[model samples]
Target: MNNIALSRWTMSYFVTSLAAFAIAQALMVLGYGFPQAAAAAPATLALVHIVALGWLSLLLCGALFQFVPVLTAHPLHSNSLPLPTLCCLIAGTLALVCGFLQLAGDIHTGPPCFVFAAVLLAAGFGLVLWNLGRTLWAARPLSVPARFVAAGLACLLAVLALGIVFALVLGGALTYGPALRLVHAGLAVHIAAGLGGWLTFTAMGVSYRLLAMFMLAPELDGRGTRLGLALGCGALAVAIVGGVAAIGMGVRTSRVLLIAGALALACLVFYGKDMVHLYRARKRRKIELNSKMAMLAQASLAAAVVLFLLSLALGRLGQLLPALVYLLAFGWLSGLGLAKLYKIVPFLTWLECYGPVLGKKPTPRVQDLVTEQGARKWFLLYFAAVWLGSAILLAGFAPLFRISAAAALFASGGIAFHLLRARLLLDVKPELRLPDGVRKPNILYSFSPKASLR
Candidate 1:
């Protein structure tokens, strides 16, 4: 283990991200987004941003703040920056949501909110890129995981710049010819960059490292892994270039995007093969709950890919795209995140509250801080609801979709409660408690003033 210093604000990020996720699910249950309204409806846009910027982006940022050091054996440029970053992200997301509500005619606020949102989000993401980027750069010749993060950061910059343009255009601050054309045709490109390049690529990289660590499998740096990375990069490059070209030519769909999709699919195939190899080669005889839940998440990704191909073959790609996106966002990405947090929260809690007393006193194992048996049903329920909801949406049944969303929200709440239990050290046995002198950490933050593990 690297034994790096703890990230003081990571738990705060996790808490906020979970709250955002629950809010997004609540919106779904209330029929605020797709299937209830047009895919491009302002309410749907608000819901999407809540999931993207508020939930997944914040979660990823927190993970990276901790994970980058492990990958590079170096510290962040400055730990002080993350709290500020979190504040900016939260404030910006709220402003952006309100701006969208204004567009939906539910509020009367004007262009200033949009511009403020764009500025705040840019500042927040820019700080993240600077901190993590500098840490990776100092490591010199980077590992594959580090390379993935670097590429993802590049994609994030592109997404941020495009988002700024989008916000300005929506706020009527940009009426120039090119900006207007991009406003009309660039949404798909923005989605491709944000979801495909930034989120998926980063997730792929993080999962490669984390799965190996958790499974007791060898680190994979073979040709297959390399090829998968190359293909993913190629796909993103093609998508961005093709998207820009389409915007310039005043078109929406392009053969270039098709080529990009094909490359992305091939990348997924390689990634899937690597995952199979990891599982088959693992030394751990008994897989834990988190790994098991992660397998379901991987299965969700496979299902989404299969559905996409089928929809394309049946000439229903446009109609099915929203369902496919829902599967990716909720089933694959969010599912994987929730699964990992089930383990990570306890592990970090153990380190934060138990590490200093390890040699001097008895302590609980990390696993002692969580009850996998009690939590498993929630994981299962969450995935089931996500899959059922996607199917209902595909079948054009909005009411059933809302019901499924409610089920998912219930499952998510159950999962969050368990994570909170872990954070609070509620599951640790009385005999394994720290000695009288050692202070237990706060439920959602570290107790140490210096934020060092030792």
Candidate 2:
């Protein structure tokens, strides 16, 4: 832990990501996408990009900026890169959203926003890969978590390349027959690579380390972890290859995709089993609120897998795909991200403020910076709303889905407020604060001078 350098721009990434999440939720509550429009509708595309690019990608980038070093026991290749990377990502996301709106005939902006968006996104993701890839490369024979991250980075590159081509086709910059065919057939592969390959794979890798650390459990170094990683990578590879072949060569790849999906499910089974073992083997007897809430996220993943398998069996997979996506995006990914942030924000705050003064003076424990009782309800409300919303969406009830989305929005707001409170040290005792000379950390930046703390 001592070897891990602080990521100065990570909090900025987190704050921006949360803002994007709020906007996405607000859009849901307003019925901007999906149930209100076709799944392939422009408005739906805009909303999905807001969640996927603006929220989840940024969140994942922030976490990686901080933890990649922790995983490899090496410093980041460059600390100067994250701020510029964040800027590019934010600009790209906004441009992409506008491009979607332009396609929907909502905004009549000229200049082909999709092209700009794709360029900016490619540059941003390229920087991320360069920085993290070098760091991982410097430490050869990577650990299990690091290997997962490496695989995810490769997927991110694939996602970027596919996305850029899609953007070009949509923006009228690419009208060649092959390009058009790729667009028509590559959507599934693009989505699967981004969501499953990049986001979920990276999250799985980070959780393998973070959950263990938080639980005081042994880090997994066994066959199940290895198998899961291999299968996950294999699944993504198969999906990409099959999709491309179906598009360009006019090949039948349904069986290939089916095999990929089966492998994905198997990957999940192994991961779930490992998580169970992780929890059972924990050295810490008392679980904190973060770990407790993460259980719901794990359960959401399980529920999603079960529902997906059932829908496929019933030949209703297409009908239930949106619900499954909702479950994955909000219930599993967002839920886990928020659960981890509950602890991470406070822990980072503690480290920044009290680390230098430790042993020299009295300081609050990391737990003292937050009140779990206040936050627990918000986590419960969030997961409950997500579950209800997914079910309602599956039932094709738009109005009820919006209502549940409002509940989710409310709960997310509460959770964000709690995280903000932790960041500001607002919940810490005044007596504890006065003796330690602790001050509120910057809410949206991490570049404050160390001298200011003194």
Candidate 3:
């Protein structure tokens, strides 16, 4: 197997994505976007897109660039792809945010701005899909991660196409008052595709491989993983098809959507059980801080699933919808990404700096490049604040909800600080190294049995 190293520029995704998260949190606390009273307000829409596209989407693209190659044993098609992808995303996101702000201000000019933003964002998505899709196409017989990622790219394509049409409607380029119903139905479908089909699917696929690598665990159960993927894809397809019917044919397929939701919940249960088995079968006795926090994130995902089903059953799904979004976005997606970043940034830094010097001199192990002790408290605080915020949002206590948002904002700040420090290799106390005579130093990120340290 060949060893593959990802682009150094992928770090751009880490820094910029976290910055966008901080901005979104601040907007929530300040009542600019994500206001408790007006869930569908323009500012709220802008904030959601920022988090979804600029933050989460960019982060996923960056990680996949690195890990896709790692999983497929094939290097990225182009190291240059990430830098341009970043440019397009940043520009498009800023334009979209501005358009939303204008709409919130009741400006007549908002529609045109939205159209322009749509064009830019579509271009960005086009580049990303082409790049990643090409890489996957070249590799024969995709791995599970590759399969999930390819599925995600497909969903992303659907998302962008729908978004462009949505933007056109808002821009008054399409005038069918009756067709506006389609927009409403499309909204829910869009969120489902973005969150469930794209983000959740990709995260699950990556975690299966990543957790095993980090924990020295047995490889994930192939049959179980494939089954979960199949279920999830089926669920997403039903939801998308039902949504299209509602939009194009003006048919409300609520029952179809409900079935999709049930299938999705089942998919989660399957993946969760597989994860538990993976943890139990691990060879490593000592679990790292990142993995510990990741388990919490996984728990949050499960909690979010339960909440969805309960809301649907009780006929209170609307009341609890925002809370579900909160749990999924911050608690599940952001939480896992943040926890993993603690390890990824440092490990990448170690590879770039210390890996070359291993035989020449005493060098730090991957674990020594970051201080887990310093980051654990922050992780705990972040999750606690997320839970509190989600509960407060569901309770319909406006002032209290804002307070919880503030707590989340502060906790996110702490996380950003720790991640930045790790990226910079600041305040890292090198652990004692083995002498040259004791053992041969392992190559970082290599697949060869002689090269792998873990």
C-alpha TM-scores of all predictions: 0.97, 0.97, 0.92
* Residue ranges of candidate 3 with Cα displaced over 4 Å: 106-111, 176-181, 430-454
What tens-digit string does per-residue lDDT give for candidate 1 at 297-339? 9999999999999998999988999999999999999999999
Residues 307-342 of candidate 3: C-alpha lDDT, one tens digit per residue: 988998899998899899999999999999988887
Q: In terms of TM-score, how similar is model 3 to the real structure?
A: 0.92
- For candidate 1, the lDDT comes to 0.88
- The TM-score of candidate 1 is 0.97
Quote the positional error of residue 230 for candidate 3 in Å.
Answer: 0.5
- Per lDDT, what order, best first? 2, 1, 3
- Would you list the C-alpha lDDT of every candidate in the order shown? 0.88, 0.89, 0.78
Candidate 2 lDDT tens digits, 1-454? 4446668888999999999999999998888998888999999999999999999999999999988888887788999999999999999999899898889999875778999999999999999999999999998889999999998999899899999999988988889998898898778888888988899999999999999988989999899889999999899888876777777886666777788899999999999999999899999899999999899998999999999999999999889999999999999999999999998898888877776677788889889999999999999999999999999988898778899999999999999999999888889887776355555578876633331111
- lDDT of model 2 at position 192: 84
Q: Please list all clashing residue pairs in model 1, or write none if there are none.
A: none
Best by lDDT: 2
